[model samples]
Structures are given as C-alpha cells and as structure tokens.
Target chain A: MTVDSRSEKTRPDRAAATRDRILDAAERLFAERGVLAVSNRQIGEAAGQGNNSVVGYHFGGRSELVLAILRRHAVAVEQLRTDLLTRVHPGSALHDWVGCLVRPLPAHLAELGDQSWHARFLAQASNEPTLRAVIRADAKASPSLRRAQEGMFRLLPAVPAEVRAERGEMSRLVVVHMCAEYERALQNGVAPPSRTWETAAARLVDAVVGLWLAPVTPAVLGPDAALRCRR
Target chain B: MTVDSRSEKTRPDRAAATRDRILDAAERLFAERGVLAVSNRQIGEAAGQGNNSVVGYHFGGRSELVLAILRRHAVAVEQLRTDLLTRVHPGSALHDWVGCLVRPLPAHLAELGDQSWHARFLAQASNEPTLRAVIRADAKASPSLRRAQEGMFRLLPAVPAEVRAERGEMSRLVVVHMCAEYERALQNGVAPPSRTWETAAARLVDAVVGLWLAPVTPAVLGPDAALRCRR
Candidate 1:
C-alpha cells in the first residue's frame, strides 16, 4: 500500500481504539461517582489521555458523551429485544410482552459480568435533569422498544392511555433502578436479592406484569379537591 | 439575666439558624445537581456563609449532611403518616395501608409548595452508593414506616417474605422517582401527569397497591440457568 493509504487505514483504527478506551473509563467513573460529579478532565485522566481536552474533542460535551455511552449499549440491547420479539405473537400473554420490555437490559448487563457499569451509569444519567430527556428520547427512538410497548398495549385495550403511560414510566424505573441496585450489590460483594440476571429479570417481569395488569382506580377527588384539601 | 447567660442563650439560637440555612442550601444544590457533585464549599457559599468550613463545622461530612437533610423532612413525614394511620384500622383495606405508605412524602412536599426539594434530594441520595445505605437505614428506623409495612404484610398473608421485600424496594423506587419527575415537571412549567401532590399520591397508591398485591411468579429456571445460558 502507498504511504498515504497505509497511514489513513491505521489512523481510523487508532481513533476507534481510543474512543473505546474513553468510553470504558467514562462509564466506570460515572457509575462509581455521580454522573454530574465526574468532570471530562477526570474522564481523560482515567482514559490515559495526556490531554484534558480529549473528551471534549471526541464527544463535544457531557450530554453528547452520555448519549454516546448509551448508544454504545443500545445496539446490543435493541438486538436482544428484537430477538425476543420474534418469539412473541398477537396471542402471546402479557407476561411474555413484559419480558421483552424488562429482559434486554439486564441480559446485556449479565453479559458484561461483575465489572459492568452500564446499569449504574444509566441510573445516574436518568436522575440528572439535563440528561434525563436525552435518555427518554433515545428510548423513544428504539424500534424494538416501540414494538414491545405496542405489544403490551394491545394486550390491555381497556386501560386508559394516561394510566398506560404512567405505568410505562413505573416499569422503566423499576427495571433500571433494580438492575442498578443489583449491579451495586454484586460489585460490593453483598448478596443481591436474586441470584442471577435471568432470575432478577424473571422477578422484574412478574412485578411489572402485575403493575400493568393491576386495575386502574379512578380519581375519587376532582382536581380542585386536592387544592381545597390543602387549604 | 446575667450578661454571660443571656449571650449563651442567644448563641444557640444563632447556631440553630445557621444549621437550618446550611441544610436548606445543601438540599437545593444537591437536588439541582447530583448529590456528590456539590461540595461543602458550594453549599457554604449558597447559604451565604463567608467561610467555606462552616459546612464542616455544622454537618461534619457529606454523609452526615445528607442524613441531616433527610431527618429534617422525616419528622414532618412521620407526623403525616401517623395522622393517616390513626384513621386506618386493622380491618382497613390494603389500599388504605398503602396510602399510609405513599401519601406522607407527597403530602409533606405539598406543604413545602413548589419550591420543595425533598423528593429530588432523596432521589439523588438514593442513587449514590454511600448515601443510599444512610437513607435506607433512616427509613428502617421510622416507627410509622414500620407500622405501615406491617399493616400491609398482614393483608398480604400469602406472599413470600422475599417477594414482599422485593416489592417494598420497588415501592420505594416508584415513589421516590415518580415524585421527583413530577416535581421537575412542575418546576419546568411542563404539565405533570397528576395535577397536585395529593393527586400524585393517589396515583402512586393505585400503582403501589397493585405492585404489592401482584402475584409472584416462582422461578422456572435453576440458579445455574443464567450462567449456562450465557455460554
């Protein structure tokens, strides 16, 4: 190969390796420390970069860096969800659909083993005001996630749209926080409630299915009642 | 009174006021930023203290500062729960007991008005590895919370202990996060899913009742199944 072509081929390879290293360091630091607590300078130091500006150069800003971390795992998680969806059908039970919603993330974490920081990292990101919308929008963009939500909604036609939306948010919280807690437990050498990710996912599916299938209680008090009661 | 005695009494009043200021500043900063992200120096400056060591003098450490913030709200929350429990008899429905569990925090937040930071503060603390245990231990120490849990357990005679424990954690996550999200929405001028904290608590009660009452699905896979499946 010509000198120019050889250098061009190796340059992209080196850049990709550096990107991966930075991502790994950022994820672990963000997970261990709070997301907003850890600075880009710290991330660069952790990634073994001599230049403090390396994080900004690669990712532009914190929000972009968080999104890149999320998108890195999104592909594998989306594929897992899509794979699970293939087994689901129009007549499948609500439990099966809930499985599609809950399993993919934990399954991905399980593959990462004890050293994985994705769950905790996402948990931190979800609580940050600036980053929360980013995470939600990313989830909204997922075709497999959309399919899973649709599958669940189809199974519960009688549920009100608002209640469904509310329960959907609850399910997301439970899965993310529970997995984060489980990840912390494992890393701390403390016993987690469930023995493995599959079992933890199973427990989550049960509770989430219950959350979705639970009867909606109509608001007994008018909107003004709460205000009146407060006064 | 003697001049020395009068000065002694006034000094305590001044110290008490300083402590409250420090707590208020720390809570708001921690809520807006992540818990670990905000430092003692920032908290002192926000509280209008000229000396950075004031936080160290009053609260000692980050964990203690977090606990002090939690304790500040715990009294009002406990009182609210106690009053709610007075109306709840042993024969009261599970929903009533769930109300005791869910309503107190939201009710307390309602009393604090739009500017309250307790929910968001707790949400931030709960996600932090070091502070999470402090919050959990504080919750475990509450008499009213213990009563509410026992009341629910009485109604749920058939559920396994582990399942109950898992559901309790789920309940805590839902309450903390949903209220945090609602508070953020209200502050941002975005419409929340519920109109008021009272109404929000009502929605939470409905979902948590379902969570606690939901049937547990026993594990179909062995402990080794997850490990084996990975291969």
Candidate 2:
C-alpha cells in the first residue's frame, strides 16, 4: 500500500481510541465527583491528552460529552434489554417484565465488572436538570426500554395512570441510586449489603414490584381537611 | 445606652445574619449545581460577600458548610418529626409509622413555601460519600427518627434483617430523590405528579410500606445456576 493510504487507514482507528480514552476519563471523573463539578481541563489531564482543549474538540460541549458517555454505555445496556425482552412473553408475570426494565443495567454493569463507572455517572447525570432531560429523551428513543415500560404497565391495570407515572419515576430513582450505591461500595472497599450484583438487583426488583403494587391514596384538597388527611 | 454599647450589641446580630446569608447561598448553589461541583468562591459570591474567604471564615470547610446547612433545616424537620411522632402510637398502623419517617421533610418544605431548597440540597448530599456519611450520622442522632424506624420495623416481622436494611435504604432513596424531583419541578414551573407535598408524602408512605413488606427472593449462588436464576 502507498504511505498515504497506510496513514489514512490508521487515522480513524487512532481517533476512535482517543475518543474512548476521553470518554472513560470523563465518565470516571463525573462519577467520582459530579457531572457539573469536573471540567474539560481535568478530563484532558486524566485522559493523558496533551491538549487541554481535546475534550471540547472531540465532544463539542458538556452536554454532548455527557451524551457520548451515555450512548457508549447505552449500546451495551440496550442490547442486554433486548436480550431480556426476548425471554418475556405475553403470559409473563409482573416480575418478569420488571426484570426486563431493571436487570439490563445491573447485568450490563456485571459484564463491565469492577472497573465500571457507568452507574455512578448516570446517577450523577440523572440529577442534573439539563442532563436529566438529555437522559429522558435518550431513554425515550430506546424501543426496548419503551417495550419493557409498556409491559410492566400492562400488568398494573388497577393502578391509575397518574400513579403509574409517579411510581415509574420512583422505580427509576431506586434502581439508579441503588446501583450507584452498590458500585460506590465496591470501589470504596466497603462490603455492600448484597453479596453480588445479581442479588442486589433481585432485591431491587422485589421492592420495585412492591412499590408498583402499592395502593394509592386519593388527595383531599382543602385546608380544613388537609389536617385530617394524615389520619 | 451609650453608642459603644449599642454598636457591640448589634455586632453579634450582624454576624448571625451574615452566617445565615452564607448558609442560604451555599445551600441553593449546591442544590442547583452538584455539591462538589460548586466552589466556596462561588458560594461567597452568591451570598454577596465581598471577601472570597467569607465562606471559609464562617464555615471551616465544605463538609462543615454542608453540615451547617443541614443542621439549619434539621432543627425544623426534627421538630416536625417530633410533632408527627406524637400522633404515632404503639398501636398505630404500618402507614402511621411510615408517615413518621416520610412526612417531616416534605412538611418542613411545605412550610418553607415555594422557595425551599433543602430537599434538593439533601438529595445532592446523599449522593456524595463523605456527605452521605455525615447525613447518616445526623439522622441516627435523632431520637424521633430512631423511634419511627423501630416502629416501622416492628410491623415487618417476617422480612429478613438484611432485606429490611436494603428496603430501608430504598425508602430513603425514594423519599429523598422524589422530594428533590418535586422541588425541581415546582421550581421549573412544571406541574408535579402530586398536587401537594402532603399528597406526595402520602404516596411515598404507601410505597415504602409496600417496600418493607416485599417478599425476599433467595439468592442462588454458583456460575452454572446463575443463568437459570433469572428464568
């Protein structure tokens, strides 16, 4: 091959590797600290990039950088969700569908092993307003996630739509924060409550099922009745 | 009184006001941004302190500042908890005990009116390692909180202690993050899932009661059986 062709052939590969390094560094820093806490300069230094502006050059801005990190993990997690979805059928119980929603991320983290930072990074991202919208939009784009959500909701016909939406948010918070806590525990050399991610996820699935199945109390509006509502 | 005596008396009042300003500014910034994401310099500026060292001068470090803000809100929340606990008796139902655990913060926030940031601030603090420890220790110190916890656990006689602990964490995560989300939604001019904090707390109490009552699935260890466990 010509020298120009040889250089051209390696260019994309080199660029991909550089992008991966930056994403890894950014994810770790964002997870360890906070999403808005860490800066591009620190990310560049952690990634071993000579140019401080390399992050900006590659990712454009903070939201784009966060989206890139999320998309990187989402591909693997999305595949896990799809795999789980195949096992779920029309006759599946609520727990099975909930597993489709809950297990993918933990299962993905399990595959990533001890070095994974995706859970913590996503947990931090979920707290930031702008990044939260980004995550919601991204999750909405995932057909597998939507399917799992729909399947879980299908089993809860007795639940009001508004209550389901609220419980959905609760389930997301529990799963995301709990997984992040588990990851943090492992990294800190602290013994997590569960022996394995599998066990933790199982426990989470149980609590979430309970959360979804909980009875809703109707709101009683008015000042005089507000005091008596607690009883 | 003489001019000197009057000036001396006002000095202490002025110092208290300054500290309150710093605490208010720090809490809002930490809530809007992440805890570690914000700097003392930013906090001081937000507080309208001309000197950059004002935050450090008032509060020795970041943890101290966070603790100060927490303690400021805790006094009010603790009082609300105590008041709620008075209404909860040994004969009270599971929901009553759960209400004791869940309602105080939301009640306190409700009293704080539309401008409250404690929920979001505490939510952010709960995510940070050192701050999470600080929060746990603080909560453990509250007599009313311990009483409420014991009351709730008493009703769940069948749940394994490990599972109880796990659910307890889940309850805390759900309450903290859900309240935070509500606060954020209110601030963003969006309609929250629940019409009022009172109703939100009611929903949380219901879910937490269900969570504590969830059936535990036994963990089956071993690589060969692991894949089959999900099925």
Candidate 3:
C-alpha cells in the first residue's frame, strides 16, 4: 500500500514510503522526547531519508506533521474502538459495555508490534489544540463513535445529556491519565504496572463505570463512599 | 522583591530580574500562543533583554523555562487550593468540598492579574515531560498541597490508596482540561461557552466530584472490590 504524498518530488511509491518512514520516526521520537523537543531534521534522519526538508516538504512543518500523526493514529484507534464496540452482543450489560470500552487497547497495542508509540504520543497529544481538534473532528464523524456514544447513553439512560457529556469527557480524561501512567511505567523500566493490558483495562473500565452507575446521593458521596467502597 | 537567580552568574539581583522578566514574557507568550509554538529568542525580545543567552542564562533552556513557569504557578495554585480547603466549616457537605476544588481558579486568576497567563501556561505545561517532572516533584514537597490530598482523601474515604491516587491525578487532569477550555475559548476570540466563569467552574466541579462519589455496592465492597472498582 502507498502512503499519501504531497510534499516530495519522487516516484509515488518512493514518496509514500519516505513519508511513512518520517511519520513513524516522528511519532516515536515525539513520544520519547516530545513534539517540541524533536525537530524536522531529527525526524528526517530517523526516517533515513537523509533530507532535512522531507518533514517540511511532505507535512509542511512540525505542527502539520503533528496533525498528520494525530489523524493517522486517531483513525487506527478510532477504528479499533469502533470495532470493539460493534462486536458487543445486541443486549450487553453495562459491565460488558465497560469491557468493550477498556479491553481493546492492549490488544491493539500488541497488534501494533512495538510501533505502539502512540500511547505515549497520545498522553502529550491530548494536550495539543491542533491535534485534539483533528481527533475530535474525526471522532464526531465516526459511526463507531456514534455507536459508543449510544452505548454510553444506553448505560446512563437516566442521566441528563449534560451529565452524559460531562461523564463522557471525564472518562476520556481518565483514559489519558491511565495511558500516561502506563507510559511512565514503561519509561521507568518497570514492567507495565498492568499485568496484562486486559487487567489494566478492566480497572479503568470498572472505575469509570462505577463512577456513573450511581447510588451516590449528593450528601453521602465523597469519603464515605470511597471508604465504604474500599472496606 | 527579586526573582530566582541564574545558577551560573554571581549577579544575583540582575540575573533574578532578568529571570523574572523572561518568565513574565514567556508566560504571556505561552498563554497567547502556546508552549509548543513559542521560542526562546522571542521570549527574550519581549522581556527586553535583547539577547539569545537569556534562555540558557536564567533557566538553562526552553524546557527548563517552561518548568519555571509551571513551578511558579503551581506554587500559587497549591497555596490557594490549600487556603480555600482549610476554611471549610467543620461539617461542610460534599458539594462544599467540590466547591473548594473548583472555585479558586477564577478567584486566583483574577488575583494573578498579569500573571493570569500562568493558567494557560500550566494547561500546556502538563504535556512537557521535563516540565511535568519538575512540577510534580515540586508539588510533592509543597505544603499547600496537603489540603488537596487530605480533602480528596476525606471525600473518598472508601477508596484504597491506589484508587485515591488515581482520583487525585484525575482531578488534576480535570483542572488542566478546564484551563484548556478557557484557553481555547480565548484563542478563538470568544468568551468561554458557559454564561460565566462561575457557572463553568460549577459544572466542571460537579462533574469531577460526581465521578468520585459514585455509589458503592456489596459488589464493590467484596474481596474483589479493588478489581471491581476499576469498572
């Protein structure tokens, strides 16, 4: 398969290969360092193109490259998340819906075959306005995303739309933090704190689902619930 | 009062002033543009230093400078968060605790005046590893941070140590997102989507608090409670 090309003057296949190599290197380097710390020249070197202009020529600049990395990974993640949600049996329970939400990451990361640098990349990416906007725009158009949305709405039918939106947003933030924790663990030379990605995924899914499953009356929510739940 | 000095130069006062001026300009630029997009020379010029050496002289480099900005604001935020939490009447309700968490941003942002740039600076700062590490380490030693830890612990007494840690991290992420939303709104040359800052703060606070306060069941309190709680 050919990668898309816009900035390079080469054979279509060569241009595509060069572009993919640049993005691959850029994503990994950005995760290891950061978007700001890595440079166009470094990305070019890592991709083996031997041309500093490749990043600018193909992606226009670092910002645009970041946008490209974001869009590319978002498509992959978006599809995986969608596929998992769609595979849910027609009448899955909230717990099953929760499973569908959390279970896919490890599996997908495994499939990524060490190219899963995007997990760390995402921790930083979620904070970038340009990248976040691209991801959000694509998500808004995703049918699978709509299905996930319906899954949440179905799970929290009693909750108001505003509440649902808030919950959904919080859930997304929790995932971001979880990935950061995982990234941090990996960086520290610690085996993933999560035994199997599934276990870690389970914890995240359950914690979030527990947050919304609601028996919490406004008055008795905080320490009481936390302590009570722990005990 | 003098700002912090450069480690290299013996001119503590001049170095400190230059450092503060650099920080001032950096914070402003970060808020107006973003950490990823701005550069050291621009920061130097805006500070009226007219020298590229300022980045290396005062803060070691761009990344450290970002850390300085984060450390500076994190100190102030921790203090305000602490002060707000302490005055909680002996028997404040959960909502009161939630309020303690949310109300200070706008209040402190106002007090910050020119330094209000610190909020958006922090929003982007969370993504920078060197900066994130510095702020996190510094936060661990900050006295004002105690109230947040204890307050959240009080609020979620039933949660285990690990879960509490996760919740605390999530709470911080929520704050970052709130800061980002405000930054984005301003970036687009519009006021925040909420009718008022207070209204936005209230909704965001409620959403965060609501997640932690979710109800605990016998299932949640079982031998597998910790495991189940992840859901």
Candidate 4:
C-alpha cells in the first residue's frame, strides 16, 4: 500500500531525467509502432534502462507511460491554442484564425523546436483509443488549454455550449491532421511545391482558413441549402 | 507468387457466410484494436476458422482484411450519407449536413441496424494513419463512393479542390471525435443526456459549415472594390 521506496530512492534530479528519457523514447516508439505494438521492454531499452521495470518504476505501467508523454506535451499544445486565439481580431477573416491555428508546427520544426518529436507523437496519439484518453485528460487538465477555451468561449459568446465543444473537437482534429501530414511529408522528403517550411505552413493555414472562414454567411434555408450552392 | 487455390474456391455461394464471419470479427477487433494490433491469426481464430490462413485465403491479408470490412459495410454507410443529404431541404439548413454526417451511427445503433459495428469500426479507422490509406484506396475503388463524390461535387460546384479536401479531412476528424466519445459512452454504459449527441453534432457542423459558407455578400464591387478584401 505504501509508495515504492525503490522508486523514491533515486535522486529527484536524476529521476526526472530518467523519466524524461523514458517519455522521449516512448513517444518516438509510439509514433513509429503505435501504442499497442510498442512494448514496455522496448521502451526501457530505448531509454537506456536495463529492464522493463523502468516503465513500472517511473510510471505505473504502459498506459500511465502514455499519459505522462501526453501530459508532458499538453503544455506546448495548449500554448499553441492560446497563440491562435490571441491573433484573432473581432472582425478578422475566419481563415485568419484558422491560419493562426495551423501555422505553428512546421514553423517550429524549421526553427528546430525541442518538442518536435513530442508534438508529432501527440498528434498521432489524438486518434489512438488506447492512448487517446490520456491525451484528452491531459489536455483537459492543462491551464493553458483552460485559458484558451475560456478565451474561445468569450470570443464566441453566441455559440452554444454544445457548439463550442464541437468546434473544439474540430480544432483538435485540424491540428492532428496538419501535424501528421506535415510529418509524413517530411519523412517522404516530398518538399511540397511550396519550397520552404514557412511556405508549407502558409499553404496549410490558407487551406484551413478557407474552409473555416468561407461558410460564415447566413444561408436562406431551402430543400437544397445543405448542399452549399455557390453565392 | 501464384494466386492461391482458395481464391478459386471462394465461389459466391460458399463465400457469403465465410465473408460475413470474417467481416464481423475483423470489424469488432479493428474497433477494439487498430488494424496493426489485430493479427491475421487472431482474426481467423475469432472468425472460427480452424486454420490461421483464413484471413489470407478469404481477404488477402491484414490490410486487405481492413478494406474488406469497409467494402462490406459500404452500402449501409452510403445509404446513411444519401439519407442525410436528402434531409436538407432547399435551404432548410446547411449546418445540419454536418450532423447528418455524424449523428447516424448512434441512430443506426438505436435502430438495430445489422452493420452498426462495422460503421463504428470505420469511424475509428477514419482517424488512423495505417487504416486511412487502406480506406482511401478502397473509396477510390468504390463506384458508389465515386458516385457520391460526384453528386456532392455537382451540388457544391463553388467549393475549390483544396477546400473540398480540407473539409473532407475535417469531416473525418469530426467522425473520429464522435466515434471515440461514443465508444467511451458505450463502455461506461452512459447514455449521454437526451439531445446531447444531436446537439453536439449540430454544433460541430455549424462551425464546419459556418467557416465554409461564410456569407460574404459580394456587393457588386467594381473589380477594384472587390480587390479590397484580397489581402
């Protein structure tokens, strides 16, 4: 019933480092092999630990390890959300908001941000059921995420609670798809005709913005209105 | 290297029950564990085939097995889409299209549709990378899907290619969120508050459609006036 003394014996600084290493290794492997395919032993080995005990020692188990990885990165992810909200003007084009949301990752990768791998891994985890709960829980618990949501709620006063939740879900998906696709593009070395990472980011932002900003006008309801006929 | 005799042995009459068994097991497992996590042997065993070769003999392999499940439920899925599209009156509401796309799974389950599990599995696969390609390839090969796409293209003629693609991606994420939430709800046996599912679906569709159908009344801006918003 007591906390594991074996885990507590390690110095706090060293323990933190080991935990980071395990998380780093785990995210990379999860990104490459998926949550189910990656084993605790493999994660420990990747972290330079001698045995599978690290997974249990540092975290309770594989599931907990996944949560830790997500928890660690939830800060950066939430900050990205805040950054977008800050950039939106009351009258700004909807796409501008979309651009603000979509443009960050490649921009970071180009600048060589420390958490690029973690970002990519988190994006992948967004869809994974075994790992998705961890990501959602971490995201929900993030102060930055809370602040961002609050800001969005303030900006979208007219949007219903249910609508806000739905919009939030779409926002998450847009980020996941953009990040995952960007990573795949890098892996394939297919420099999208855009030429620069920033350019690629801009294109993504444009496409996202166009989709989000394009349909805000009130529609005259009719049998075929759902089909989105041209104005 | 050679085509297996099993392929020849799978005449339409003998294959119906076997194919259904394969699909039922594959869809359930894929929903529980992704395509990579569910092995051929596991699928064969679950399908009640004595030999592990049933997956290959019946559906090619793991990837093909995933595609087979998609194809098996293609009719039901498409019917759902058509039903939703038809529900939108001339202009009754465009935002409902988003709900139409997402709400039907729960409705299908409520109605005791035969392929509800497969729909849930496909919803999960929509967010997965390994299965995305398989599903996309199958969609490309499916005449019904192409016909549906053409039908949509004709209706939304003003939607740019890139915009269409982005919306499609966004739609996938919407489905993923709904499916993931539904799965958790089912696991917990919690019925979301009445109107919760429909409300959530409507809210998401509003954001998606709002951004796409933004009402910019193009005032007969002499070319110069029209150019004002270009930047």
Candidate with top DockQ is 2
- Binned by DockQ into CAPRI classes (incorrect, acceptable, medium, high), candidate 1 is medium
Question: What is the Å distance of residue B36 in model 2 from its true position?
Answer: 0.8
TM-score each candidate.
0.95, 0.95, 0.76, 0.72
TM-score: the better of candidates 2 and 3: 2
Order by TM-score, highest first = 2, 1, 3, 4
Estimate the TM-score for candidate 2.
0.95
Query: B101-139, model 2: which lDDT tens digit per residue?
Result: 998888888778779888999888888989988888889
Say which prediction, candidate 3 or candidate 4, comes out ahead on TM-score: 3
Q: Candidate 2 lDDT, tens digit per residue, A1-231? A: 457988889999999999999999999999999888898999999999999899999999999999999889888889888988999997898989999999888888877878988899988988887998898899999999999988988887577666777888889989999899888777777855446888878888898988988877776566744574344
Question: Which numbered prediction scores highest in TM-score against the true structure?
Answer: 2
Per-residue alpha-carbon lDDT of candidate 1 for residues B1-231, written as tens digits (9 for 90 to 100): 457887888998999999999999999999988888998999999999999799999988899999999989888999988988888899999888888899888888888888888899989989987798899999999999999889988997587666677788999999999999888778787855446776678778888987877777776576576653222
Estimate, for each residue in A76-179, the C-alpha lDDT of model 4 and write its tens digit. Answer: 54555556667566566544555445544554454443335654576656656657676677667766456534443444436444444545566666666666
Look at candidate 1 and tell me the lDDT of residue A132. Answer: 80
* All candidates: interface RMSD: 3.2, 2.0, 9.9, 10.0
lDDT for residue A101 in candidate 2, whole number 0-100: 91
- Scored by Cα lDDT, where does model 1 land? 0.86
lDDT value, residue B200 of candidate 3: 46
- Per-residue error for B23 in candidate 4, Å, reads 2.0
